[model samples]
Target chain A: MINLKHTKMKNELIKPQGLVKNANRRQFLRMGTMTVAGAGLLLIGCNNDDDMVPAMPGMVSLGTGDIGILNYAYALEQLEAAFYAEVIKGSYFANASAEEKTIMGDLEKHERAHREFFKAALGTNAIGALEVDFSSIDFSSRTSVLGAAKTFEDLGVAAYNGAGQFLESADLLLIAGKIVSVEARHAAAIRDLINPGSADFAGDDIIDSNGLERTLNFTQVLTAASTYVKTEIDFSQLPS
Target chain B: MNLIKLLDTICPDTKSAEDRDRFYSRRDAFRQFGDFGKKVALAAVPLSILNSIPHVAKADTASLIGVLNYALTLEHLEYRYYQMGLDSGVIEAPDRVIFQKIRDHELAHVRFLQEVIGNVLNGTPVAEPGFDFTAGGNFTPFSDYPTFLALSQAFEDTGVRAYKGQAANVKESDVVLTAALSIHSVEARHASMVRRLRTKKGLDTVKGWITNGSIGSLPAATTAIYAGEENLSHGGVNVANLTGIDAAAVSEGWDEPLDMNQVLGIASLFLAN
Candidate 1:
């Protein structure tokens, strides 16, 4: 009975909000236009919405249960990896030296690996690729780009730390531990690049005088995430 | 209510009522009644009695989950703060990059948590809630960069300590524990960067994670509260009771952890008026 209640509760939580009324209207119009344009493509190979990449601003449905959370992480890695790749590909920074370029490349590779690893783990349940809008970034300047890099790396590290406690499975936790540490290293390296002699990265501020790490709840994290993702995420089903 | 009734109310799925009755029978009836009466009376007591009972929820396995939620909440706060900073146009070119990167990192963190809850924990990620960064205008407005930095410093410093405080909850799960701590270090790095920025801009950066103390000068109240307690400090440093960290010792490297109640209080700063 307890398990049944849990299941029911989860189902209610994960039920995707039917597309917001306004969004649905927009989507209907867009789909109508696309259908006319791609009728030939559809006949040739494409199926339907399943094959179509989810539109921008669509929530990444993690589904119900633990699998949903993993999908969520996978979805995020996809975004990060894609962003860094573009940043590197554009060579957005002015006066980019070889060393900095190499580091950027490494970061890109790590993000890609992170994305792929999750995709492989999730298999069929993996989220569809997302379309990112980076219009706000001024990629031409080194300071602008690297500064953003530092923020991303740092946020990644803290997110992992905060989320680690909620993991129930030992195996998954182990995997997360490895990935989070790597992200931490990334954060440290980025911090060092931004400001020299300031990598006193792991101090009482983070660990506390008691030698412990900090943690946060999912609702808090998702709210912060909402702005950047452009996609609305519904985490209503997660355990309180 | 009788003890059996209370137990049933709390855990409705016990294997057998007989088993529960038997379990309660092991204790002295008179003594148990006294304890139960005390609990009942406490429940009816007003806010004044709160301190006495402390409302300290007993530590349980679920605490691990609670700690994670707490950490996630901090990331959400940071992400929003950076996003607003970037959009405000007050931030300069270099600062804009910094804020954007922070924004990305926060988004990544949110995604990571979403994955863990859905996959490993077999739970759905919690829905996002509305957070008011302005804490009822208790402090300076976030629209000002200096004010924003101060709040940022508080958020980052608190994040560092919150992770540390929750570290023990994950210890039984070594993998999760290590990952949590790893992230904790990264939060410390973020706090340091923000602090440096504040200092560079001629703000009082020392009030953040470090305090000056010597044979000549006594620690401030904030410094004193955090003195030797850096291990437990989180989010906002008790600026009035600050303490410095030794650059040498590994364990002593971070600031002290704050009490969970203190953390929640500070978090309330971001709540809407």
Candidate 2:
């Protein structure tokens, strides 16, 4: 096996963030022996690096704790950002209004901003950007763009709502709470654009009889999300 | 703040035996704490202020009840706001369905919270206090569609912030925390929907999210609901660090939470004197 020390050091310099500069891999042993198990279980390294893979491959487990949860959130944001970024690359269909185009641009900026926020906050513990396959979405069609936006937005909101239970740190919880509302707002706007009426904004199908939005666990969310993403996300390791 | 009485008033017809027993036991548990139980309903510490204090989530059922009651109070105001609007026979012909949908959710939220907080009401649970969305002599929100929309926007925005403000307080209980956030996002969707309706009618120019102190002027009394929603910081990161990200754009990026006291300060305005 390649020397873990040499490979980690090499990867460290390559991914140095202008902000959120944290990488515990170099200090893994000293850190691991002294630190409480899973206290800061944000251990991260490439799986197929040939030198040393810090995490398991074949399917990436979002891990089992707060760090895992944050990484899980980061993965979703990446998919959303990539989707919006792609939507903007195509010309507006004839039926797409100026307002709709502007809204799409605004949403693109918001999703990209969210994507970067999670990436920076998680530091090196963050996963490398996963490949996204938005092939199923036809960016040029108004119906297609808004429909996919609605799905991602609603999914993002529900995912955060469900994932809040797993967050151990209140600070992380607050961040998730703040972002979830943005997703909710996005969902409403997309729904309105699709159907253009007050009734559609808070539609019945997505909300339950008690008025709560739909919820999905990590696995369920990954199931729907991975359809648009090329990456194989596995939540088998996430703890109850 | 007798929570049971308050629940009874807001939901006077609430005839659930399960709820009655739950509130009674919670009261019994609080009686286990004597006078401290009574104070818990009014003693909820806001999450922002809670940073300096230690979290005793495991040992303190009193604090948990305090947080739950705070949520319940806000739900009371929202349900009544919609209930009155629906009854006024003034909702635009096309929009009653939308308002009805929101009212149903608020009512559900009130019930959901009552159960989550122990499904119990105590001390008359603080009566449903009167609501005058127009603040006694102001514009008649219930009679005018524009005024009604403005008030709805205020209440929903306040609900979103109020829900967020309690996350830290409930973090100790995963079940309650998850449920609270679920409602929080729903409230935000309501806010965005109201804002969209207003924009559709040319009543305002607002984004789905509150942008840079851009909450349009409604009643002077309702100002506090949108107060501080312009904040651009998240945890420790400042949005200023990002390219092309300003405070205005940042404001839309993350919705800020309002402390319990601040929420009450606004809800109290609509209370029938």
Candidate 3:
């Protein structure tokens, strides 16, 4: 039996982890959006710093059902696209080698395309541009940048796997499967960059003894991703 | 309730009711295979459930092997592909470890599938056939690095699409579906690594993911893998109208799947017979 305990993967994607068998309203609030500048953050709803509630003022409810999951993915792509866009915006990172720069640059376009596709696929249902908070990531260092990339890539892969069971439509699942593997490829590339000369691309952290990649539920993902995002997300439509 | 609707309870994901007839014929096709056929026939019928999951032994037995074998054939091809690359002695020193690791993963997948399918069939099916990377003397992939990178890209990209295409049929068996997807992601990772290597060597300027027909047009011999990938439509919906994004990027964002026949056709190019 595949033991799914709602595991929270420990990585740089989110800060501070506490294990919970399931995600309730309290846990949902802890999940935040990741921010990147132009071509990244898209805020869907209102924001009230002073008002504190489970739905949270200015926080966007990922909505319910499949639409919500699409929104959730859209939000993550926004975060990743913005992060990479910012990475190249500066001095092209003096520390990054020429090869790293080219690959990372290419990565930015891929992420941006993903963000836009979800935006298109969702159409009227697409969430507003998410605003990511990147204060925690050190943009100047290659280690910091690639570390963030690795986390996003792995998280994206895990996210798709975790969400697979929740999806009801075969068409959606097929597309999701298509995208997840691509993300896995990105994860491998970033892993190679961060730690070359090793097979750590599918390291123990993401894979199990069975050679299967680890997965995370909506609640688990929100709990960790919330730290980097300014917009609060209500996952009421998703599994608790 | 019938087994499939009941299955909808635990699975929470079910395709439309219209697809039921399709399942019936699929299961019926396997009925010619002796006891395995009978088991598959029953598993395909959604009329009743002795238990919620039916018989695990039965479900994993018959048609499942067909899917597993399909997977194994590809894995066998991929495993040998990297193995041959390593033995060719043409891979650069820096990238040698990369190929070695990928080779190990493919071998693991081959072993994993063989182990499962072999257990079900009570014996291993068959050994891998000989391969021709050059595709009937069409080109020289081994001698030249650029040629090698292009072919590597094709294999990895095809692997991704191949897995995606078969997912619908495999989803019926929970264990098999999950395992297949696990391998699918690894294949995706392999494809990505190979693409990055291309860019590093300046053989190609491409995105991490296959876009609007695999970075750029591939040679006609290996073009089958990417045939339907350039479509910008998701279902009936055009991505551009939906998101206002460029049609090309919209198509690039999602990699499409290739049916079993399409995959076999591509894989056959490398196989000697």
Candidate 4:
């Protein structure tokens, strides 16, 4: 009999090593303590700064079902758009080669469109603008900027891959399918820029032995994303 | 969370002793085929169980099988194209490795789908079809590096669009849906790499992403690969109307899907039969 586990992706690819470190840094607060601050707005209570509870004050809820998935995507796109927008303004972009500038400029616009598309789709149900912190990145350095861009783009691909299962609506799933490919394209371009003309564009780290890209679940995606985002998103309502 | 649900259980006593004997005999047949059969046989265990599920409707499994077969056909086309391209010594030393990587992926996709459809799902895998890379003598891909690169770009982009078109069909099975999405993104990655390579080679009109659905220096026959790619509206929102993002950005932001008929129309050009 064939080993069925071969059909499933390697566990490490689906749940990367960063997940464990991320889990430790940002703890998932339980539900029931959440409060609806206003019509269509859900908030989570702030932690008391105890070791067990991470200080998650006024976290926004992504709600449940398909809406929650859209909100989750919207939040991630916001982070990406903000990151690229920052990249374009940085000294690295201003002093970069013509090709590099074109790539960065196009990336900024694509991410902005992605963020705005989700915002329009969700309409009133959309989550508020997420505040991202790029303090850890050195915008003036090409290595730093491209490195961050690569991370966001790759993570976005994985996020969409894993989130597809949780979506109840096929239409929503198709929409995600459309966006994830664009993210993958961006990821490849960023990787190529970082290491010109190398196979690292589709390196083994992200694409598995089976030629399939990484697929991280909701919690895993948010944990990795939490590194750059300052907003405390209460993903409790989002499907696991 | 039952994330990788490739058929949870097989109802006991569903298969007769004769059926079990036939399965074992088939396993013996598979062992003779070497690595491909060995890998397929590994996944065969669970898929055989899936065939005997009592409560799950037969159509659900059948539809999934159909989708897998459809994907398998495309993978086969890409695999053979790259294989022949490599064998013909048309690719230069600098670009050989990238094409090799892509070829390996297409082969993996072919084998992966074959394992599920032929062994797991108990359905027949589609036979590899004859291909004419020249597309009825319209161009020479083997002797000409530029034509080879053009076809590579078209096939990769078409793969991305084809998979996206089938996303909704496979959404019923999370296992299949996730796998398909994983492949879809890789196609996109390959497409980006090829397009960028073309731009560096002096096809300045091309970028990693499609520019307003233009096929750049590629022949007009490949126009279908980029057809409908310049879609500005998605889910009822015209992205062009969004602030700070122009019409080009809106078109490139989200890729549009090509239905099965549209894909086959393009694929048929390369299909010898």
The most accurate candidate by DockQ is 4
Displacement of residue A154 (Cα, Å) in model 2 is 0.8
Candidate 2 lDDT, A84-158, residue by residue in tens: 888888755335677777677777777777777777766655566787877888888777888899999999998
What order do candidates take by DockQ, descending? Answer: 4, 2, 3, 1
lDDT of model 2, residue B44: 45
Taking the tens digit of each residue's C-alpha lDDT, what string does model 3 give over A1-240?
111322232232232332232344444654553222212113222222222223445656565556667777888888889988888875536567877876676677668877877776665566677678888888877777888888888888888877765655677778788788878978987898888756777776776543457777676666667667777565545533
List of clashing residue pairs for candidate 4: A2-B41, A2-B42, A3-B42
Off by over 4 Å in 2: A1-61, A93-95, B1-59, B118-126
lDDT of 3 at B211: 65
Q: lDDT per residue, candidate 3, B98-172, as tens digits?
A: 788778778877776765555323234457878888888986877876787788888888888888887777666
- lDDT of candidate model 4 versus the reference: 0.77
Q: Number of the top candidate by lDDT?
A: 4
Task: Go through the candidates in order and give each one's C-alpha lDDT.
Answer: 0.51, 0.70, 0.67, 0.77
Model 4 chain B poorest ten-residue lDDT run: B3-12
| CAPRI-style quality class for the chain A–B interface of candidate 3 | acceptable
- The alpha-carbon lDDT assigned to residue B247 of candidate 4 equals 89
- Identify the runs in model 1 with alpha carbons over 4 angstroms from their true place: A1-57, A199-213, B1-273
Q: Tell me the RMSD of model 2 versus the true structure.
A: 11.5
Mind giving the per-residue lDDT tens digits that candidate 1 earns over A1-240?
A: 112212111123223343354346445755654422112111122223332323234555454344455655666676678768877867553357754675576567567656665665555555667656566566786777776776566566666666655555444544554455446555655655666543234433444322234443455455444445655554433333
State TM-scores per candidate.
Answer: 0.42, 0.77, 0.72, 0.83
